[model samples]
Target: MTETLAETTPHSDEPIPAYPMPRASGCPFDPPPAAQALHDELPVAKVRMWDGSTPWLVTRYGDGRALLADPRVSSQSTLPGFPHPNAGFRENAERRRSFIAMDDPEHARIRRMVTAPFAIKRVEALRPSIQKITDELIDGMLAGPNSADLVSALALPLPSLVICTLLGVPYEDHEFFQEKSSLMINRYSSAEDMIGASDALTDYLDELIGVKLAEPADDMLSELATRVGSGELTRREAASMGVLLLIAGHETTANMIALGTVALLENPDQLAVLRETDDPKVVAKAVEELLRYLTIVHNGRGRVALEDIEVGDATIRAGDGIIIYTGTGNRDPELFPEPDRLDIGRDARRHMAFGFGVHQCLGQPLARVELQVVYGTLYRRIPTLRLATGAGQLPYKHDGLVYGVYELPVTWDA
Candidate 1:
């Protein structure tokens, strides 16, 4: 039912718009207007990337979902024509092959080892501990300065503490790992810088895995170490898994906590809905709505075509690069009514914020519980919580893999 490029653009002479288009300053939460415009006219259009490769930029919700779930589309970055986010990602794509970048069977094998700890039931069981951490952080915030940077005070450290405890990694060494993670995900980092960061984290994890092997504990790392000892996984493989979980566990959730707080503060109507809601179901729905409104992973998920696949109005040829723009997809009008508006009551469970198919986030349950507890607890405890600065004045993480506020300055009544 889709049209090929030959049919749609035989006489086209206009240059394709570049990818990673800037969001309109007036509407920082929305996806780039230029990209959204593409969804209106041509849901699947070609865009040149940083590396000068023209990949199909899928903007339609249905098309993005189809491509993401299709086996013909691959997530493997090592493929010759894979669409790497930047020079830095391209340089280290093959070197750091976490389960995220691998195909089925191989990806499934390693993902299984860590899946049990993150299952919905398991993650739900940690809610009490997570709630305790959130309260403690908020208490510290209240006891200290009237005005504080939420990123350092509550947003960043809460997740850092949780992930560190879960992985059995020392929280005292957060600075080292956090710096390496920042370098690894920064858009402007050089190839060498990315490789160096990867190596440093890998080396650190390798040593930690050694420690866990000798002195086993009741933690995710200890489980991985047991696998290594039993010859089910190599030491290097175990270490790589540790690095992936450590970085991913904290970074996404931390950003969500900070950015979600800002978004709620900016939209008072929506904020009221969350503040007044005591029902767990309502809080859970609000979390999904926030996830959809701010699809924080601004960078499109990249893939290479294993075989020719037709989607929407284009035939993706084998070796063609593809970038599924989930940010735009989440806002597609067809998927959600008034897609631009953040409606807490809407059923947004189908949103691609954590992606779709087998590659959907492994830690989503944990993230959901964390957000539910924080959003439910933070506003109730601090009813007057509001942003200290204008939303436009705040700096955003446009240059990083994940989209979020760098420092959310907030104030509430004492």
Candidate 2:
């Protein structure tokens, strides 16, 4: 039987630690040291959120993997104590619920409508196009000054352009799209400000959905329009999905590209592993290693338990909020021996970077292809590429919902 919060929650005189704990400085690639200690000692423990509500934090690899896949754990944003990643997420969640925040039947039903565009065959067909633009971006980057901020020059534009092409979002509107996404992702943004930004984006996307409905095209939006036309999804739900895709498809992938570049530059031996490899398998493995090493979606995955559940030694009772800290799970020495080291050659296929089970990243195939293309080509093409500024001085995204370097100032030989 499920227990009440007071009956189940272990409380003491000591204050509960904060979620998204501080990472050790100069080691931005690794999981937070405090979280790692929790993995070793109390893998299942309580932590405080922004609203002062305590949630069960699962840090061990085994426990997190199991709990995330459990049917009793609900992703529905409507759950009373669902652990929101940040104040902004908590703020706008109810007004802007996407299919990703829904439970099984609803999530599966809605997610499948958009799956065709991301099917391996469909995504693979874009490889030639991806490569062409990647080369064009690199050409543009090299033709300009030797020193450039890779984030603006290539990292940000590449994914935006690609996803725009795939989803039929006008490339011209990318700046506006990026701006709204920024407001939503800023953890410190007030509920009023974030909700306004979200509603505006929803309105914008709903208008575009209308356009797709009027003049159907061979893109994902048109596909969504067909569903809307069939009454399979309400207009707002379809638009919400569009907003999710537009932000998720670009932002996280952009971060990985820029952050991965910085990581490889810092560890040249690993950089050389990519630089020297001609095999696609080697490049793919390296991408996984990078994903494992720097799980940049550092915010813990949030859910609420529907029934009493055992995680580690603790019983996460019914209605208890849960935050599965994937970064800490990736660093669990039990699953990954000497987990701190970044080894491109090691088999990181089982990594939880894209997460595990039913809610694993929908855009992962496209992301993998993009990363493989960049990691395989970038360093090898420009063998001398190095940081224009010291790694220590580079601005990292400490407060943003996604963890990454804000600007990657890079330089290479003529």
Best by lDDT: 1
Q: Give the per-residue lDDT digits (tens) of candidate 1, residues 65-150.
A: 98989998898999988988888788777777889999998889989989998888888888999999999999998898777898
Candidate 1 minimal-lDDT segment of 10 residues: 2-11
Residue pairs in collision within model 1: none
Q: lDDT per residue, candidate 2, 1-414, as tens digits?
A: 445544654444457898779888888887888898888878888898888989988987888899889999999877888988666677667778888798899899989998888889988999999998899999898889888899998899989999998888999998999989988887777887788889888999899999999999988988999999999999999999999999999999899999999999999999998999899999999999899999988887888999999876698999999988889888767667888888898888888988886899999999999999988888888899999998888898877788888899999887
Q: Measured by TM-score, how close is model 2 to the native structure?
A: 0.96
Candidate lDDT scores, in order, read: 0.89, 0.88
